[model samples]
Structures are given as structure tokens and as C-alpha cells.
Target: MNSAVFYSSKTDMWATPQDFFDALDAEFHFTLDACAVKENAKCEAYYTPEQDGLDQPWTGRVWCNPPYGRNVGQWVKKAHDTASGGGFVVMLLPARTDTRWFHDYIYGKTEVRFIKGRLKFGSCQNAAPFPSMVVIFGGEHKNE
Candidate 1:
């Protein structure tokens, strides 16, 4: 367990499982990156908070991978709005189950996949000592 913690923290990026990515690929049918979302996937749009700014344009099929921190509410809210606006929002983050974001943003609105075990981050020390989840909402062609 300690080894897991040590690895995750160093890697600020929470590593997602292959199954999670596969599930997303199955639906979107496009090659996904930690950053951009290309239109070539037959996908219309892709949005990542890591980009310019939150206020930037959000059009077509959108994908958001926001920074997860203590104040993750903003990210959660944005993802919810994106989904409500007829866009697909797939989130990968620590399963801070006790937080309000877990209840409001994760609990009922999307499909949640709890990873079976701890994972090693690319080169990061394990700041996250526990399992993570992949929360997927909306659909490829689902309308708001």
C-alpha cells in the first residue's frame, strides 16, 4: 500500500486503467490522448481544462479532464454542465467518496468504474494511496 502511495503522488497525473480507456474507445471509436480530442475520431469536439482557460469555447462533442485538487467542485460543475448541454464528459480522478462532488457529480449522473486495485503512476510518487474511479457521462450521440 505504501509503495502505491509513493508512486502516485510523484505522478501528478492519476493513471487510468486500460479497461476504462477501452470503454471510452469503444463508445467514441477514436484514439484519445491525455490532452486533446481530435475530430478524426468521428468525434465532433474535445475539451480539456488543461487547455487555455475554462471560459474558452465548448462546441460539438466535448471531453473534459480537469485538474483534481481539494477544490474539485469547479471541475465537477463544469463536467456536469457539459453533459447537461448534450456533450459527453468522462472524468478520471481519485475516488474521494466523502466529498460533495462524489454525491452530486458522480453518484447518480454517470457510470462509475471503481478500479480493482492500486496502480503505479508513470514516474510520480504515490500521493494517492487509494483506488480511483472513471466517471463517464452523456453519450456519443445522446442529446441533452
Candidate 2:
């Protein structure tokens, strides 16, 4: 497995500002400006280097919009590990069907909330229509 830092940019770690984070900013009690590019952006929290912050075990509701970079598989795996260890992990990930992460970690473990369209990312807010999925894991497992 690759290091968590590989998933983020060296210059700017944050990628997309999550929608869920924006909806309930007060509840999280954190600021989005310093971490992410946009302010009051309706999104979940962006992924940081595990060395920097993601290492700790997070309890309760958790949000993660992992960086879409070289070693994204590692981050996705980490999210799955977080979910498995009794932590709520909500992730906004690109629908990369061919990747190993999609097959092993995501495919059969959880129910995916498929987005109707592509999400607008940071900076240019590019309209990426490559299909995305919101994988909710270890939150409320009433069905199972």
C-alpha cells in the first residue's frame, strides 16, 4: 500500500470542497477556507495526508473527499479501513471501475449513492462528467 500523502498535492493538499461539509458547517465546528480553496463550498471535508492528520481514529459522523491523484487507491483503502473499524466514512470518489480499489474495497462492502452528474471541483470548478459515487460506510447499518 502507498503512503497516504501520495493522494494529495504537495503545493496544495485539498482538492474538492465537499457538499456535506458546507451544509452542516456549524455542526463540524471547523473552517473550510484554510484547508480548501473555496469558502462556504457545499461539500465534505477534503482528504489530508495521513501523516498530517488522517492517522487518528475518527468516531461519530465522518466525511472524506479524498484527493484524486496518483495513488488514490491507497486513500480509498484507508477509507474502507476506517469504515471497517467502526467509524463512519462517507467518501466522494471518482467512479474508476477498472481500479483495484473499486473491486476489492468498494464493490460489495457498501451501498453506493450514485450521483446524477459530475461534480464541480476546485479552482476552475471543472464540470467532470465521468460519473461519481458517494460510498457511505459504517454509519447506520440498519439494513444489515
Q: Which number leads on lDDT?
A: 2
Deviation in Å, model 1, residue 111 alpha carbon: 1.3
Off by over 4 Å in 1: 1-12, 15-23, 30-50, 60-63, 124-128, 139-144
On TM-score, the candidate that comes out on top is 2
Runs of candidate 2 with Cα error greater than 4 angstroms are: 1-14, 17-51, 123-125, 139-144
Clashes of 2: 7
- The all-Cα superposition gives candidate 2 an RMSD in Å to the true structure of 7.1
Screening candidate 2 with a backbone cut-off below 3 angstroms (N, C-alpha, C), the clashing residue pairs are: 18-42, 18-43, 18-44, 19-42, 19-43, 19-44, 21-43
Per-residue lDDT for 70 in model 1? 60
TM-score of each: 0.63, 0.64
Model 2 lDDT on a 0 to 1 scale: 0.57
**How many clashes in each candidate?**
15, 7
Cα lDDT tens digits, model 2, 26-122, are 4444322211223422334432343332455555455566556666677677778877888666667788878888998989888787877766554
**Candidate 1 lDDT over residue span 1-144, tens digit each:** 233432244434354444555566575553223233232112334444345425554544454444455645666777677778886666666778898888987788788878677654434444347677767767544333
Model 1 weakest lDDT span, ten residues long: 34-43
